[model samples]
Target: MNQILPLELPNGISLEIKREDLLHPFISGNKFRKLKYNLLQAKSEGLETVLTFGGAYSNHISAVAYAGKEQGFKTIGVIRGDELGDKITENPTLKFAQDCGMQFEFVSREAYRLKTEPDFIAKLKDKFGSFYLVPEGGTNEYAIKGCEEILTDKDANFDFVCCAVGTGGTISGIINSALPHQKVLGFPALKGDFLKDEIRKFATNQNWELVTDYHFGGYGKVNEELVQFINQFYQQTQIPLDPIYTGKMVFGVIDLIQKNWFLDNAKILMIHTGGLQGIQGMNTILKSKNKTLIEVQ
Candidate 1:
């Protein structure tokens, strides 16, 4: 079982860490929460295989691959990136997926975009045999149900709850589970306010809203400010946050607090959706620039 550590922030804001990083070997982090229900639902329905979508280095893909192997379910990942079958080196995500016996299928950007289409999902089954298809970010009803467990386990009262909004599953779950008195804030990594509706597309009720303007740059974009935030956050919490998902969300949360968005002494629970391996490349890219990334916070 993972630990939920309580944190006392410098500004008098309090929160609890789900410590999902301690979940298991490969099936770790919020990924477990995000994937648990879909897998269970598939099992309940007697589906023998799981099919999902992701990029070359998607944490979702990594989790699905490892979980599928451990649970003895056939798994296929529709990957969107440069073809890797001929490459000698693979990103940690891809390498882990391969190690877990996940079958990989490459799709062009055009075809990959249509995977969510009913016709496209049907075609996938016709081509690859029978499978239970999950959306790219696992944004299905079952995924939301899995994520909702995070809130159910908490008995202590918190004024607010926060998490990175990728496919909005976790936020949707949190919103669904949070009572009317609790506030749910989602820091979306994407630009624009479009995700507010996208989040509601899942299961969020009146208790939630996506903070759309905090993406430091944009979806998948990072800068020195975020680098500084990640370094300082790691130094203070000993939690390694990748720039892609968790780092941006953390940065947004800190900014929200600093900006007085939260009541001065409000208690909040900021979830760390683990994707630390995604930073390996960013670290390499920054190291090549010959500057040590440090947080001044």
Candidate 2:
């Protein structure tokens, strides 16, 4: 954990960020947390293969691929776009996963929506044989359990705990383990109130709320302002943030602070849930669009 002192702010308001991104080089931050017990469970079940879902540039896909490779499990990624099948070399995340020996099962976006359906799963089982399944975004009871350990006893001093919300597992774990005096604030990377219900299913308390205004359009959507902010934030903080999630959360937190949304004398702790691996892929997209790229460390 480190205090952020570069940004001038209101008196008595201090900001600190947990460098969960440094937890691992590839399987970093919340992905590590989300997969900790999941891999263990798979091992205990004697499962030799792991299957999961993600989009073209999904951080989860990359993390699971590397993790499975490192842990000696065969990995399969159900990618959302069939067209991305031949474009692996152009997409860093997918290419990295492919290099890690993750087999790709590309499907149309519409068919990907049926991932949770029994028929879809049955088809996958028929094609790939038996395997352990992980949900998209890597959220589940085991994921929440791993994420609960993210905050240490020393973290209890902060008045607010902030983290980027994706699939709600990370924040749900934070909510369950937060100190009585600390409020957990989640900045959702995707649009919709649907996450509220999804979070409620796992979170045990009412001390957390999702901030929806800073999504920058929705998941995988970013504008010039967001891109520029991400670049400047890295320049100032020397901490690279993925535009899809962490960058938006940090932007929202700073904006809220400037607007006096936090109480006077509040100490805020932001969880740096890692998705940095996706920056290369995002930069590739930005280059094609003539947009600014996120700074790399």
Best by lDDT: 2
lDDT of 1 by residue, 1-297 (tens): 233433445667765655556666577667888788888888998998999999866888888998999999989999885365554153667877888888888878888888778898888888888887888887878878878877655534788888888777778888888888888888888777767777778765797767876787787777877887788777877777778887887778777777878887787777777776567656656677875554322
Q: Considering summed lDDT, which 10 consecutive residues are worst modelled in model 1?
A: 1-10
Off by over 4 Å in 1: 1-11, 153-155, 284-297
For each candidate, what TM-score against the reference? 0.88, 0.98
Superposed Cα deviation of residue 158, candidate 1 (Å)? 0.9
Clashes by residue pair, model 1: none
Error of 1 at 169 (Å): 0.9
Candidate 2 lands at a TM-score of: 0.98
**Model 1 TM-score (2 dp):** 0.88
Candidate 2: where is the Cα deviation over 4 Å? none
